[model samples]
Target: MTLRHTRPEARPAWRKSSYSHNDGDCVETAPVRASVAIRDSKDLSVGTLAVPHDAWTYMVDALKG
Candidate 1:
């Protein structure tokens, strides 16, 4: 995947979900080129889950509905 080729410094900055309550149970997200990455906010080593941009949008829209 293209994400693997992304340099650490070149990766987009991750931001925690707005719904997060500043607790340990938060998730962070970042745009990775055409995809969006989600990861545990409490542990950087937990790994990331990347989803297609459209899929991410769909999920967000569904939740908002």
Candidate 2:
């Protein structure tokens, strides 16, 4: 499966991680079809990291372990 990379926009509503603290070091995510859009909550204009749904699930599972 080919993963397409697209520029992140402000149209999608991004939500910050629940584990994030008030220190300003938080990650935000936006659901985009079968993919997920991630970016730093502090500076959204910088860019975003897009990952496939399965890949994102694997990452979260690994992080939990």
Q: CA lDDT of each candidate?
A: 0.81, 0.80
Clashes of each: 0, 0
How does candidate 1 score on lDDT?
0.81
TM-score of each: 0.78, 0.74
How far off is residue 11 in model 1, in Å? 2.3
Q: Kindly report which residue pairs in candidate 2 clash with one another.
A: none
lDDT of 2 by residue, 1-65 (tens): 22245666635677889999999899988787778889887875778888999999999999999
For lDDT, the strongest prediction is: 1
Question: How well does model 2 score by local distance difference test?
Answer: 0.80
